[model samples]
Target chain A: MDHKEFIRGGTALSEDEIKSGKIFVEEDALDCRYAWDTGVAIGRYLAELKKGKIIAKKTNCCDRIMIPPRMFCELCYRPSGAWTYVQDTGVVNTFSISNIYYDASRVPSGEPNPMPAVIEIDGASKGMGIMHLLGEVKPEDVKIGMKVKAVWKPESERTGSITDIEYFKPY
Target chain B: MRKVAVVGAGMTKFARRALETPKELSYQASKAALDSAGMKLKDIDCVAHGSAPDAFDGIHQKGEYLADGCGGWNKPTMRVFVGGATGVHAIAHGWYHVASGLADTCLVVCEEKMSSAMPHAQAFFLTIFDAITERALGLNLIWIFALEMKRYMERYGYTKEDMALSAMKNKNQGLKHPASQFYGGNELTVEDILNSEVMASPVSRLDVSPVSDGAAAIVLASERTARRLTDKPVWIEGVGWCLDTAYWATRDLYYPRYTEIAARKAYKMAGIREPHKEINIAEPYDPFGYKQLHHMEGLLLSPKGKTVELLRDGHFDMDGNLPMCPSGGLLGVGNPIAAAGTLKLCELFWQLRGEAGERQVPGNPRLGVAQAWGDLMQVSSVVVMGINNA
Candidate 1:
């Protein structure tokens, strides 16, 4: 009388079973590419990075300053105000020293551990931040409210992208 | 609004990698649900479909590609997407279709094919981040989840073991579910979950739901049509959905305010003021072990920062005060994204009708709530169902 018994369907395929050549399987990769527009806010923000400066938008609503800058304020449904430069220093809102990579594979023991954090930038609206890597400090030393500064690539090597600032380090 | 009730539900076995194509998975689950309702495709008035990102399935215009498989052919076929919340939102859309005089019957279907995303589903998620700011930061999906989990534990002083018990609970619950990925022969303890490989300090490998390929389907009809189809119809008392800002960083990671707002909307419509007592059973989205606790608090079923204590007291057990995830949830049932949410609705349908058999809870439960959260940790969809229309 169990509903589970009457319930049915779905063919589970183990790796070995899939490779056993019993089922006719056709494999194809999703070959696709995209050119994502940086938009007026992000495009200008990225360009400012080459000059070794961080820029943010001061929205008309509540005078909220935002990074990863948007041309409009999401909450108030209005156009953002003037763009303003922000300090590169920030506080780590939250962070994690992860041993897993994007591919779901464990990091090799010898590889450097990745410490990713949401750094609440100074001069931006409260709790408004962008995610980035942490460096120049031991994983155990990273604190929630830790003050950090951007470690930028040499000016000549700047690429007008987020990578222009290599990582954030404890101030 | 008019009344709409769920007449039947169906699901495919949640598997790590289903050999069936996306269409085949949809067809199988759709067939089972239609058969359960004792109705044919012609009896359906319209179809509402849902699925996660096209990147996960490796197919563009997935809604169109999946239409025929879901019996949406030649009808007012439509797809509703809200990332992971697609499943529950599909039901909401179906309710709209039937409740607004558009149709007398509606079949809602949800599917996910994570196995087809070549390099890894996690890798595909990297592109989901802000291309200008986050994509270049070398982030995987684990970073954000771990960050949120860390913030939650830090705020509430919850330990790894505290969250691991949830994983253990759902794993145990899954044994009763026939379609569960961890259904039988695989029972785990709290220690096993704690000792497993840590993905990010607080989030262990076991805490994460398995990447699955499967589908789920449910049939909804207007009041008159539902009564004619089945004597024991589970009335869709209320449906609600909310989407918060995409700026997840600025949002509170310790609590999901979006889910609470969505739950409030549903509670108001269902005429239930006290959710912690009125609702008999609940299935909140649980892609991570901590999320079940997070969403429980979000649903107002348990007090904030205290769900862990209640969880430790066995309040969420199958026979406890409120049985949560009696269908094993995503942790044990296997998460195929969209299908997982729809399966939760199916759980409510079966449980409310007392047709769960051995998997049924001890109480003669009459009212239940199912919810799903998704899309940059910003959206939540909620549905309230009961034996009789409120």
Candidate 2:
């Protein structure tokens, strides 16, 4: 009979029984607002990343080139045809550094460890990439094929948002 | 295509916060899988339910709030998310409701609380990214397992002492598991997981998998209600699932093409054409220690660059020659993401019914496999069990 004595026994709760209100903690709040619609190929790729440009779409079934710019072609589901643009510079294709922070906490002893990567964007296709952030070197000198680029933020602090570029560095 | 079996199994203590309620951990793993299938929950006949996110139980339509604690009141129930392959796709949708004659007993369950997500449940895993391009790069979830363990240690040159020997052999087989949650009787090495704390750079902190709070269950039947409830029915021979493009950086983060196309559609529906020689125990979903050698080379059961020389030649220990994870899986039985894939299909139906006391595994095993993997590295879900007529 010992299937771990038929399971069930976990009642843990104590943070002073959820702050002394004697365990009745139900204070909601997740508006999770949205307006999203970046359609028509991520709305012309966020209006060509506020005109500093990056685009992509161009598809002919699956010769690649799709990027964060959609409007169809997830392997010839059709539509997507011409837009192109690309080179915000790329390579990295994998990187991490991180020292924790996105709520798993940690990162404070003299900061700078955020790294993040997956860059691969230059001229649209070969492994399409995008997850950003890698600023001005040294997380032991990056390198997963290095060569980075896209550090945007200027044109009157443009904001078509994906935080208007401001990151990928190394070049 | 009409067999289905796992007659019963259950779970719950893999804690790190579980003050019951997620419908009392789905009515204590669906009342210990309907009292280990001695049956009665009006002899079940359809339920399913497998959770993973309602943002870790801060509930919303969480399958109608976990349908009356999993017996799924008023019957014909359903709920089958695919992130962390929702408990083996809710036992492959209760093996398609008892292999399609539409239920002759089903059940299923699987829960998770993840301490009702607040400031830290890895902050709702940053809403599984890409909300406007990888959630604007604040990024979390151990930076995609430290960028897929540095593209699988730079395409198989391997190390981090070869992924801390799978977090020291799944936390030393989760110290003989009775529902382990990082089972602690000490041991852990490989220089204590290469001295622990690197949280994302070849990913450390003992290579991930913890955040838990659990529930797991199973029942399934048909084959004439599993030969009237049990004569050791582990059977559900095959089930598969796939998924792939969530554009997770346009693929190839060192292989797992949707766990080798869901292990070749469950080895072509279990006619089993050599899953590294007819599978014999494996629970592929480590929640990171190089995702158990990238799902043992995507469940073809170790090959692509030889799972770190067959995990440095112990060949996946727990008395080797193919015994991986032996229930100490989501790195020592805890990752409550869809009750850690139905606790690896209730530890392969108690290790194919010898009833896994002390996490069994010594070659009495008659074919097993459990796979889970999830979204943003894009889904996977396989199943395949055996012993009924073995």
Candidate 3:
């Protein structure tokens, strides 16, 4: 008959206990399944990545190729068409320093925090970027505009997921 | 020309947590408003309910789920959302119903149930980021605000002390408001805010609004019904609402241009050239301490970037030249998303009728404006009202 009992995670106590100030209940369940439809363009892009290839949609309006092809250009909101290839190298545009674990509920609860970076993927035009975890560098040593390279997972281990690349480290 | 007036209003007993379901809360509030308006659920031609997000309640299709609770059963009912602005937006929509002759009386309700979500409310806010982009950046919702606060401070040459002054003034007013979350608190000092736990750099825990569970509702009726309902029906003199583009990164962060545009539209309709001199009271949305100053700047009641100075000079206090947020605002009144905005409308109603005992602003105050801002700094909704002619 308590609200906390219906909640997904953590210990449940009686309302009387909480009201009496004898206990404070906190739930910690992080089980979240976000069902999202990636649509036609993105679905194809993900399939290509699974085949060990990268695809960028070409836009006639901007005369440029965009990664994770969108239905419309983010800048001009025009239609984009056809997949193109770009080398796996790009420069960092702007980045932030993060010293936190990616997700506690998704991973082992007590593991150490992961170093993360929003890297500008290589082979793309300037300012095009991807957010990938950063490894091999000390948290205190990470700086904005730092050069880094992606270290992909083994061919046997690659899944089309974002975790396909183990992390980005110093080039 | 058809004119619409607010016939009735109701709200839940605000609290940090409400044991009842949002439907139950909505039923409670809506029933009161309908009863006060001397109308039945069937009398409502249209119903508009505002809830900020499905994420807050952890229920998808929130509008559909909340529909029946708002008396939407088998009639024309729709949900309006603009983050924190949804509450006022609901009223604006209701005004259209009566003013356009589409409906004789409209039921408008705003509800938020922050307690229904798992973990803390802050945890739910983590999803506001692009999972692949900003999530890995170790960014909390506080980070965005802290960044904005830092930028606002740097650009406006506002010290943390000036921001603390707002906390003091609002909290003092909160003491009188029964529903205020921060009521009866000792005066906060500049050192208090700086020393508070830093959720993100420059944004202390004290700077944020509390997650609240509540609901508020109002009934808007045509001019004929307004005379029958009550002697003091508040008239909707002007309304303006607008949304900005979603590309927040490209836009300037210091000033809220959308609010200015929305205010201009509302003021033009209300036929006011000098807002400070003409408009007697205001309730500019203040989810955070510095946001009051930021929105005041956007409202143009104060000169560009000069609100902190006005606030410092006691210009916006309860008895100042232009009284603001006599209801204690989202900061003190507890931010229940959509309900917070409707609470402002309720405050305006109470203030204009001289019914706001203890919290009432001085003078024969007549016209007042309530504005709500939300949606990643993109949306603004304004409603200007006046006391019904005696």
- Residue-level lDDT tens digits of model 1 in B266-362: 9999999999999999999999999999999999999999999999898999889999999889988889989999999999988988889768987
lDDT of each residue in B39-155, candidate 3, tens digit only: 888778899899987877767889999998889989899898888889889899888888899988899999988876764666666676555424534445454555456657767
User: Which residue ranges in model 3 land beyond 4 Å of their true spot?
Assistant: A1-171, B136-138, B182-187, B388-390
Error of 3 at B154 (Å): 1.6
What are the per-model C-alpha RMSD values against the true structure?
1.5, 21.9, 6.9
Every prediction: chain A TM-score: 0.92, 0.30, 0.65
Clashing residue pairs in candidate 2, if any?
none
lDDT of 3 at B34: 80
Cα displacement (Å) at residue A15, model 1:
2.3
| Per-residue lDDT value at A75 in model 1 | 78
In candidate 2 the C-alpha lDDT for residue B181 amounts to 57
Flag clash pairs in model 3: A87-A123, A88-A122, A89-A122, A89-A123, A90-A122
Report, for every candidate in turn, its global Cα lDDT versus the true structure: 0.89, 0.81, 0.72
